[model samples]
Target: MVEKESSRHPEVALSLPFTGLWLARNSPARRVPSHGTDLFGERYAIDFVGVDERRRTAGHRDWRTFLATEPADRFFAYGRPILAPADGTVVEVHDGEIDHAGRRSQLALVPYMLGQAARVRQGVRAVAGNYLVIALPGGAFVALVHLRAGSVRVSPGEVVTAGQHVAACGNSGNSTQPHLHMQVMETRDFSVARGVPMAFRHFRERPRGARQFHTREYGVPAEGAVVEPLPLPGAHSTS
Candidate 1:
């Protein structure tokens, strides 16, 4: 598959959502944790949870547990920068809630496991964890979920450019680990919002278990696929 090209503002592009180590790309075969129900009446699909390749060796025993506590001096661990996918205004920002502990520990897992449903039914504040929704100029809204509490840098009605940092990734809401859950939707209300399949422009996609990175103008990583943002010039450009 090919990536769609971004002709404008090719450089000065936003840094990737994470730094340091690489990560698994999008693919259906991968088995990451997922929230929300699926098309076949399944309650979930494998979503991007746990640590990406960059944070894999932080010495935490379990991925879910690491998100709950303060780890090494990495801000992105709980507060990675969540950049705007496209220029837009802050239609919504959800914050002010504490993150839950990782589920790897028996102590942490026991309580969370029991109260999972109760927390979910509480609504967006409870289920989305900390989140931000931006309205793109083109009539699409982007939802960035699992953001750290008190880390949202943008506010409602604020206008932001594409690739601008808005918030950091976090383990909150229904998340079992530290990872960013991004999706495009047509509506502002997540309760009624249906996910729109999205593809990235000029992003580098290296298939999981593959040795080389394939440059694309635009493409969608499969459910379990791993990807990294590539530098420009060598990175493909949009037409």
Candidate 2:
């Protein structure tokens, strides 16, 4: 276990969870509202898909198809680093959920979609695959969900910082495909943790239909959009 506490380094900005190339932004392909419960009405502020060289998405419609059919291994995020988004301690860690096979066929997804409530009843054990909860120094808690099984590198009580390599993203939990689901909460108990809107600092932002990336100090990438993680100065988006 890396015991070196990292809260002191305010200068280093950690890499986004997946390293290579981002395929989507914070939300799904359709720009849908992103709360665990549609009835809850909480909105996701940042994007989940990281845009990099391998991206081929032109819009939400294209991404929806790609997510359903792509082979799990070809859509590999197997070794991708699950970085710490803030300086914090590992207050909780849950692992051992197996990654499910990707369901790209809308027909296949339809059955599961109809059974969504049943899946939820299966509870945290069924979904949320491997996960970790971190308590940030300022009292905020961040949840990293759908983590790759057996890839968690930290344990409870361990201290981590923004951008530290913690785990790898995987096709676990309620995910029909491999992707990372992240959110901030005021508390560590996720069942009751209300999702809080969060933002990336000094990152690049590209509005839909724009040809270029703009440097942003604090920005929220939309659901299903693809964005690349850049260094301090950020970079031109390939969208």
Candidate 3:
């Protein structure tokens, strides 16, 4: 427990939660106050979606996948363990949302986009899906959102070390595909918590179509950039 509440927020850089080519979208560094709905609270949230060599978010598609949405299992990110971005205590967990089907077609996306308002009014479960809140050091809180159903590995109050496997990425809540929606905040209650700017400790980034990734010590991944975490000297990706 902290002895005295510190007013000055420290510059806390975290580990990128997963491995491989994850494309960042709606990153705060690229655009201030990222999404429209983000104006509510997730003003600085970043959405990470894994992509393959061809830059496709999913694999081969068939008629079944086109007419009806495909299962989350088809996406590259599905079932990948989401690592803890920093050492922290599990402050909140909500894992009841069913992993929704993946959608890449513009036809399916239209209806889903129209329903955003309803999900907003329905509450956090509808929007954040199966998510967890980590109360990190220096009084910063992080919300890892849209996890797969039943993939959470820790319970509330449990202490988690940085890079520990916490949950698997999924297309739950208001998500259309398997991806991780991460954001930092001042408090554990994200609904009322103000967004806190966050950066990664050490990672490699390459924009789409780039030949090489430039290594960065401590910085935020730019929007549309593909990133991967640089494993610590003796440690590697958990799963």
Candidate 4:
């Protein structure tokens, strides 16, 4: 498949939402643009799924089980901590949506894909599920969606620092598996927001075949790449 052009567009400084090896999907450079709407602020959104060293979503799931279908818990990302991607004030928070089961089966995915329009019409809660919107410096509003149920730790008006534990990844809303869906917008209200460009700061990127990751600063990870966040210098304790 022809890849969508990787965006070299510079954006506000941000950080990867999770630690460890997370595989990027539907990235801005994927065959298609990362998301469906530029109207309600998701033009450059990206999806991330956790993976292990073997490049599998799970350490020991049968290949047949992975491709055919399984519960959301079967994936490697379920309940994993999703850190604050940037320091910001929480402008919006939505919770209480059921963390639905996963659907890796193409048979299930085809129907789910077809029902996307219906889900859209159901409104923000239907599409984003439980989520948080943070208003950062420089007028960027970041949305971290598809969060695990009962895992959100901040309130609408709370101030969050970068690297803080915020939520867990989950297969919520329209998500077929537990993953983090992150995007930056021009405004706080998603209904009228416009997607803004964004690149994570101080992360490590490993291309599909690379044995080691190289430090990346202010870089947007390519589609289908795996990445991890590096702690800021002196941020980790030796103990």
State TM-scores per candidate.
0.71, 0.75, 0.91, 0.88
Would you list the C-alpha lDDT of every candidate in the order shown?
0.57, 0.61, 0.83, 0.80
- For lDDT, candidate 2 versus 4, the one ahead is 4
Please identify model 2 stretches exceeding 4 Å from their true place.
Answer: 1-15, 23-33, 36-47, 50-54, 57-71, 233-239
Q: Candidate 2, residues 23-129: lDDT per residue as tens digits?
A: 44445224334553522112342335433443532123345364454445445454467787767899999989887766666866887788778867877656577
User: What ranking emerges by TM-score with the best candidate at the front?
Assistant: 3, 4, 2, 1
Q: Number of clashes in every candidate structure? A: 24, 16, 0, 0
lDDT of 4 by residue, 121-208 (tens): 9988898999999988766789999999999988988888888888899988989888999888778787887676777778888887
- Once fitted onto the true fold, the runs of candidate 3 whose alpha carbons sit more than 4 angstroms away are 1-10, 37-40, 64-67, 234-239
CA displacement after TM-score superposition, residue 6 of candidate 3 (Å):
18
Model 4 bad stretches (over 4 Å): 1-10, 29-33, 60-69, 236-239
Which tens-of-lDDT digit does each residue in 1-239 have in candidate 1?
22224211121112244433344433223322223353211111223433445435235454545344434223234555666766679999889877754454455666677987797578777877888888766565677777888888888999977656778777778765566766656567877764444556666655656666676666545454455665545432211
Which candidate gets the maximum TM-score versus the true structure? 3
The whole-model C-alpha lDDT of candidate 1 against the native structure comes to 0.57
Distance from true position, residue 33, model 2, in Å? 5.9
Off by over 4 Å in 1: 1-57, 62-76, 105-111, 231-239
RMSD in Å for all candidates: 7.1, 8.1, 3.7, 4.5
